[model samples]
Structure formats: structure tokens, C-alpha cells
Target: MTAVHASSESPSETRKFLVLLVGSIGVVYGDIGTSPLYAFREALRPFSDDGVQQQEVIGLISLMVWTLTIIVTFKYVLFLLRADNDGEGGTLSLLALLMKQTGSYMPILFFAGLIGSALFIGDAMITPALSVMSALEGMKLVTPAFTNYVLPLSAAVMVGLFAIQRKGTGAVAKFFGPITVVWFLAMAWGGLIHIGDDWTILQALNPINALWFITHAGWAGLIVLGAVFLTVTGAEALYADLGHFGRKPISVAWFMLVFPALALNYLGQGALVLGHPETIHSPFYLLYPDWALLPMVILATMATIIASQAVITGAFSLARQAVHLGFLPRLLITFTSETNTGQIYVPAVNILLFVGVIVLIFSFGNSESLATAYGISVTGAMVVTTLMSFQYLRSVWGWNTLAAAAVLLPLLVLESVFLAANLFKIHDGGWVPVLLALAIMVIMWTWTRGSRILREKTARNELPLESFIRSFEKSAHPPATVPGMAVFLTSHGDTTPAVLLHNIKHNHVLHQKNVILTVRTSDKPYVSDDHRATITPISDRFSKLELCFGFMEQPNVSKALAICKKRTELKFEIMNTSFYIGRRTLIADPNSDLPRWQDRLYIALSGLGIDPSDHFRLPANRVVEIGEQVAV
Candidate 1:
């Protein structure tokens, strides 16, 4: 069973109106939109280094467009985007969908998805620090005197930004769309002025420049592709955000507003570079006139803020998917809006991210330095996406050999090239995210198995209510003073009542009044009044009751106990009633069916977190943890 975590406005079918949709598109695209600041400038660096002329700058732009076309458009829009699990799309979502389709329990899918997503945490931390750093570096160009204080300014902004995690992003997000819109408009206008001055820059669209660079300088050109890949770093965020906006509007916003604006801005930067090669230091700032420089910097800074917000949003969503898929622990998820999933904030993630960003800012100092750490995570994720997509085709899409190979082969090569290029940066901060992702994935898999073993062990000895009641009637003594209630926190109603058996056998004096209470945590997020609970008496001396509750709603044992006390005629009282819980101790038994490691995991994890007495809403004062030594 999949776990459900917090959501903003848990999806509404009837009122999923346009404003909500468009807002989500803006939130989602912010990461990609902000890439124009450095993508082309970095791409054109080889030209500047080799003293390559105007003709070459135009050629790189052509390759930029085609990369967007092939990678983002063909793969994401045409194929991978459609591979969403239900409305959710991400590595974990794909894993879940694959598990459902294949009927084979493949551990590799879990590990790979976890690694891809965990590295994203590292990416998330650096994006904000570096994106802001890149934009603020404009101050150095606009005013050289401001150069020394850039880090202080960036730190201040980051502190203030992360400080508001508890407040939620709903209010600040209202301006995200308008700010981003204005920013894109400014980008296009700046590029248009430069593009208009020299329509010749349009030739940059010619795929030949990219080909020529690789043709002439194979290894060097291949290395720079790592930097070039940074331009599209946020494409995975777009796929991750699909659950928030749905595909159509995000696609529309990207194709219409984001795509053209980025393309023109990139061309504009190239034009500025080709026109005045001396100003290559900050071609993006110089692309516009002297008067627009300050405003452009401000707009660009705001755009980067929104981009950081998008990454933060992606982290929250990915964390939710992680929890649902058992790859993450419970997070304090706060929904920021009444009508959108895109507006969530994870306080734990936010705080950890802020600390990481600060370290990166001090260590890398600027975007260019941090750029080395950028594309490895994205390329690795992209590579995993391609591999997972192939599995999707075979398991779910049912595409024939030719159709599947046609799509997979080219992507495999491109992704491989990109992955290999980024591998060069492994010693230069690239391994940070990879390691973090591995740590998280291991924890996730461990906890899931541990919890499962506990559940399975508990379920194995379970007798059905009828059988349990029959055994209770045939095997016990009459009555005692202090009443005992067998409250079993359960689901599916298939497990045997081992606690009842142990209690009955050990204590011959049955409590004067007792009942079997089963608590049901349903898959649905919220339970209405009708679904609250149910109570049924079993026999002359016992009763069986089922209490239903939703997973998302906060469980109140006190309230449930009070209500159940009123609904049932059992003789148990709050002050006097005691809860019996059986805690399992796994001892090695060669005869046991479980894998040796699984038994060890169950014991370790059981010691770490999962205690049934606490997981259930039973009172600490009223509870007892009876240890039973059982060989695994």
C-alpha cells in the first residue's frame, strides 16, 4: 500500500479552473526560465577561447534550439511526460507504475530512482545559492564598487527567503507569475534589440556550429557539453511539477512564453558577444542599454528568486512522492494554498537546504564555480528517465521492438554522452548529491522492509474474528476486576490475534469486560462522518469493533476513545482500562523462511522506530509492551 502525505488542495475535479492551472505553469517553469542568464554565455565561451568568429556563435544557438527540440520536446513532451503515474510523474512515480505493471519486485528500480531524486536534493541546495549569485554578480558590472559586498547581499536574501518556510509560499507566489512575466518580457525585448541590430544571429540556429565544434575538437567540445547541459537543468522540475498543473497548460506556457523568451535572450547574449567580444565578461548585462541595466538586474534577480522557489517546490513534491513510495520518512508538510498542489513547503527540507546553500555560496563563491556541480545530477536523472521509459514501453506502453528501439537508442546515446561529460566533474563537488541520494534511498528501503516484516509477522499468527472468538470462548476463565481491552491497530482484517492468545493463556482471569477494537487507516486522505467508525458485539462476554479513519487527517485517540465508549456498552473505563500490545523480538532460526538480512533489518528497524504501541493512538499510561522472543 502506498502512503499519502500532505497536499495543498488535494486535487479537485470540479473546480480545477484556469487561474490555478496557469499559476502552476509559472511555478513550474521558473527554474528553466532563469537559465537564460548564463546558458548561452557559457556555450559561447569556446568560441571566445579559440578566437572563433561571429559565424560560430550563431551555430551554437542553432544547437541550443535543437537540444531543446530533441531533449525537452521530443523526449519529455512526446514520451517521458506521458509516462506519468496517475497524475504524478517522477522517478518514484515511474517506479510505482512499473511495479504495478511488471509484477516483478525489482530492487534496482528503487535504488536508481532514489539516487536520481536524492542527488536532486543536492541540486536543490545549490540552485538557489548559485542562481542568486549569478544574478547578483550583475552588481559587479553595474557598479564595480558593489563587488566586495555581493556575498553579504546574497546571504541576506537567502536568509530572508528561507526564514518564511513556516508562513507558506501562498502570498509570495501571487507575484511569481507577474514578476516572471515581466522578466521574460524584458529578456525578449533586450534580445530583440540585439537581434534586430543583426538579423545574422538567426543563423545560430544552424546545427552546424555544434557539429563543427565536436568535429574539430572532439574531447574539448564534449567536455563543454557538460556546461551547455546546465541550460536545461530544470526540465526535470517541469516533469516533477506535472502533478500540480497537469500537462497541457505547462506545455502551452513553455512553448508560448518561456520557450521564445529564452531562445531570444540566448540569441541576444550571443549577438552581444559576437558584436563586442571584449565584453564577454558579462554579455547578458551588456546586451541591453545603459539605462535598462539596473532594472534588468532587478528583474533578473526576481526571476532567479522564483527559480529557486520552483526548485524548492520540486523538492517538496519529490519528498511527498518519496514518503508515499517508502523512500522517505514523514515530513512536516504544509500546504500553502486552498487550491493548488504547487504551493507546498517542507520545513525540514527548507532548513536543511538553507544550510547547504550557505555552504555552497561560501565554497563555490559564484555560479561559474558552482556550474561544475550542476549538470551531473540532471544528466544522471535524464539517463534514468530514459532507462525507466524503456521499461515503461515494454511493461505499460506495449510498443513493438522497432518503435521502442527507434525512441530509446538515440536518447541513450545523448544521455550517455552527457553523463560521461559530467563524470569529469565527479571530484569537483559532483559526488555530493550522489552520496546524499544513496543515503536516503538506503534508509527508505530499510524502513519499508522493516515495517513490512513487522506487519507480516503480526499477520501470520492472526486468527479471524470468528475463529478468535471461538477460541476465546472455548479456552478462557470467567471474570476479573480491572478491565482489559484488546485494541489492535490493523488493516485488511486478515491477521490473527496473537495478543489475545498470549493474554488469555498467561492470565486465566479474563477482564470483566473486554472488546476487540481494530483501527482502520484507509487509503483515502480524509474520512467523512459516514466513514468515521463501526462497532459490533461478538458474544455474551466480548465484542469486535472496527474504527475507520483517513490517513491524512490527524488521528485523535482520546476523541476516538470517548466516542467509542459512548457507542459501545463495554464495561471498560478510561482511567482503569489498560492496552495490551505485543512487541516482537526476532531471533535467528535456520528453519525460518525470511532472508537473514531481512530478519536483521526487522530487528534493527524495530529498535529504531516502529513500535506498535506508539503507532497506534493508545495512551502511553495505559499501555504495556510485552516482548515475545520469536525466531525469524
Candidate 2:
């Protein structure tokens, strides 16, 4: 029986692995996969005005191919994936891992993570507008009539996309794999048939050609280099989506399918442009015959929409991570999939992205114009990721300074060059992302600084838990004791909860059984059931219960309490229990630690947070919220 079971399980495991590999190709590679739609054409556009040269074609393609090789294939797929925080990856995940490993909060690393996250959110807004516009622009080649409808159509598609986010991705995710596979195969075929147009285009495979182009092209070369950076714009998704599909599957999909398809398609574009330079305006679409042009355009539209969906979902995930880490206020998060914890919807983030996309579509009006704004956020994010990776290598992996610098410095130099190249577009449209990132960074900084001051101020005035409990128990005329259990939620376990103190003063009674509950977010992505809850007895009538949740997890207090009941001596029937929570009314104080403007901003930010009852998933009927006014 053991031998038969082992043999059967092997095939099942193999099938599951294959499924993951395909899924990763669909979701993980979507953004980068759609780059061929615009990357080559845009890179070649600046030179086309003077009549394109053969070396420029080969050189640009060479620059693009090598960028994919280094940034996406080497830096992200191989290096960053290994830095997962309990199987999770991304800027914040890496930050959490570093803090855990170093056993302290490193301010520089914290700000690096914040910058990466803010830039990513800015990228999220641009990607949908850029990708969708580029794809739909192909229709102009199908018929000049499409020139007018492109912007409106792009806006409509995006509006519809955001509308359906609440419905979840699970139902549509199965189709994503098959549709993307077809897209890749179609791209490879399009590129393969055209490679013979100029076999010399193969010279782009040599990194030396990239160097030759960069050196000879002069100042204009930097502008062209900015366009080349577009090819690798979506590379960070590979690292950001690491937890969804794991490292092996993502790497496998990249090496086996994604890279090859991208290389073939780009080489094909280079070859087509070399043989017939006039096709420069619409080289990607021109690769196909007239009969197939419209169909390819339709297919490209689907692929870009898929790409946009992946980015929008990533923004939601990042926002939730920020909330858990206390970088942002509690956002209204909706679980879109019952089986997939990662499939979430943040209404605010979705609306923000939608508004941003619409604004870009109208403001820029075309992919060529939007391209100027595109690379700043992506390159900025890459630079920040590189800095954080250096810290991770030195601190967590314990690499010698020289060894870590040797590996990261070159990448940093390359990324810095790209960042500087993109900066040239600031007047054109690049300021959109730079401005957006700065706005987000300011919000993050204000929240963190204000929250710290508020916490310090609150902590100073609160009574310690042990002292308050001991004094209450020994009081000559103690308050009357009630019959049921009461759970008072607190941020500091060592201090008495304001809600508990208020209840004793107002209700003039204490529960027969009382518990102080504190929920904490761990540095890891998940906490196992064995380490989920820690209980400590304070007295016969009172105990301290602390529930620990991972940053990636949703804290459901009732469910965790049920687990505690089964695993420990703690006993509480949900129907007979009361959950006491403090609802603070923050008022700005001119004399407080923060300036008046900052105090008001913090107060405004606090109002944006969801109620603790809803955020903690407490029973609505049993929740008792005690209001307290506090000056910040």
C-alpha cells in the first residue's frame, strides 16, 4: 500500500508543479511580455527622424536584450528571489526580513523600502495607461479611423477592468494561463518568420554592440537609453509576486518560456526594422501580414489588459502590507477569493488607480507621449531595490562588504545610468511619476512620524498593567464583579487598556473573568498555529492573551480565540463574551510635538483608518467602543 501510494502521489505532484509553472508564466510575466508592443518602436523612434541606421538598430536591440539579461533574469529571478521573507517577496517583505535578521529597526533600510513601495504605486498608475494605449495604438495601423477612438476606448477598457475587481480573479485566472501561452507562442512565431529579413540583426545578442551604440550615439543616446529601459519596466513584478507562485515555478517560467519569447520577438522587430526601416512607426504590428494585423491587435489588447490587472492587484497587496506594518492607515480590504488569501481588493487603491489611469490617458493621449513618463518610477524602484538588496546581502546573508559591493555596485551603476537617462524626460511628462512618488513619500513619512509621537505621548500617561491590576485587587471598596468574560484590546500588553479603565469607572464593575488582548504583526509572512497565541495568567479573575499575526495575514480575533480555546486552558464562549475597544478622537494641539499642519494631517490620516471592530473582525453586537479625546 505504501509503494502504491508513493507512486500515485509522484504524478500528482508533477501535475501540480506544471500547473504552477504555467500560472506563473501568465501572471508573473504579463507586464514584461507586453513590452514588445512598444519598447522596440519607441527606442528606434528618435533615430527614425534622421533616417534609421543599421548600427542604431542593432545597438538599441543589444541594449534592450542585455537589460533583460541582467536586470530581470539575473538580478530579480536569480538573486532577489532567494531573499524571500518566509516565502514572500517585495520591498516591504525584504525590509521585514532585514529588521528581523538584524534585530533592530534600521532607519535607512526602512526609508528605502518606503521609497520602493511608493514608486511601485506610482508605476501601478502608469502601467495600465501605457500598456493599454500601446496595444490599442496598433488599431491605427489597421485603419487610420482608429486614431480618434484610441483614448476613449482605452479609458472604457480600464473603467470596466476596475469595475470587475470586486468579483475576484480566481474565476478568470484559469483563462489567464491559456491566453498568455497563446500570446507568447504568437509573439515567437511573429518574430521567428521575420528574423531572416536581416540575419545580421543577430549581432544584437552581443553585449559589445550595446556598448558601441551607447558610446557613438552621444547625448541623444541617453534619451534613447531611457526608451530602452521600457523593456524591463515590469521586471520587478517577478520579485513582487514571489509568494504567489514560489521561486522555482517563476524561474522556470522565465527561463523556459518568457525569456525565449521576448528575445525572439525583439530580434524579429530589430530584423524587420533593419530590412525595412520605413516600418519603424509600427514595427511590432507590421511584423504581421495585413490579414493577421487586426487579430494580433485584439490579442495584444487582451495581453495588455492582463498586464494591467496584475499591476492593479500588486498595488492592493502592497497597500495591505503597508497597513499591517503601520505605514498606512487601515484600508478597507475585501477578500475576493475564499481559497486564495492573496486575492484581495482594496476599494480605495482601485479607485485611486482608476482615476490616475484616466487622467494619464487624456493628458498624454498616446503611448508615445506616455512613454516619457514611464521609466522614472520603474528605474527609481530598481535603484531602491538594489540598495535594500545590498543591506540584505551584508546583514542577513552575512556577505563580506567587498563581496556584497562587488555583486551590487555594478548593478547600482547600471540602474543609476538608467535613472539619469529617464530624468531627461522630466519636462516632457516624467514628472508625473516623480511628483506622485514624492506625494506618497510625504504621506508615509508623516504617518510614521506622527504615529510614533502619538504612541510615545500615549504611553507616557498610561498606567502599567501589573500595578493597576494589583491595586484594583487590593482596593478596600472594589467595584462590583460581573458574571461574564470581557476582552479589552490594547496595543501595549504591559499597560492597562483605556477601555478597561473606563469600564471600571463608568459601569462601576469588572467581569468575573477579564483578558487583555493585544494583536501584533510579526516580521515573517506567516505565523504557524503553534506560535499564533501566547497566554499568561495575571490573577484568578484575569489573564493576558496576546495574538500574533503575520504581516501577510488578516487578523480574525474570534477565529484565533477559538484556536486558543482548543489548544490551551483559556475558555470563552463567543456569545457570552464582550470585546471592549477604545475609540480615540484625536485633536490637534499647537503645543504638541508635531507642528500644527502635521498634527492636522495626522488627525486626517487617523480618520481614514477603519474601525478596530471591523479591522479586527470582532462580533459587531458584542463590541463596546469607548470614545476618548486625545490631543496630538
**Clashing pairs for predicted structure model 2, backbone only:** none
lDDT, residue 364, candidate 1: 77
lDDT of each: 0.71, 0.92
Model 2 lDDT tens row, 1-632: 99999998999999999999888888889999999998888888788889888988999899999999999989999899998998999998998888877744488888888899999999999999999999999999889998999999999999999999999888998888888989999999999999999999999999999999989999889998889999998898999999999999999999988999999999999999889978988889999999999999999999999999989989999999999998998888989888999999998889889999999999998999999899999999999999989889988889998999999999999999999999999999999999999888888888999999989999988999999989997899999988899999999998999999999899999999999999999988899889999999999988999999999998889889999989999898998899999999998888988878878888998988898999999999999999999988
Q: What does each candidate score in C-alpha RMSD?
A: 6.8, 1.1
* Span of 10 residues, lowest total lDDT, candidate 2: 99-108
Global lDDT for candidate 2?
A: 0.92
Task: Give the C-alpha miss distance for residue 109 in model 2, angstroms.
Answer: 0.7
**Candidate 1: count of backbone clashes, pairs at least 3 residues apart or interchain:** 6
Q: lDDT per residue, candidate 1, 509-624, as tens digits? A: 55655666676654343456555667666676566667665533435555677776666565446676767666667676665455777556545544543345544556788775
Residue 378, candidate 1: C-alpha displacement in angstroms:
0.7
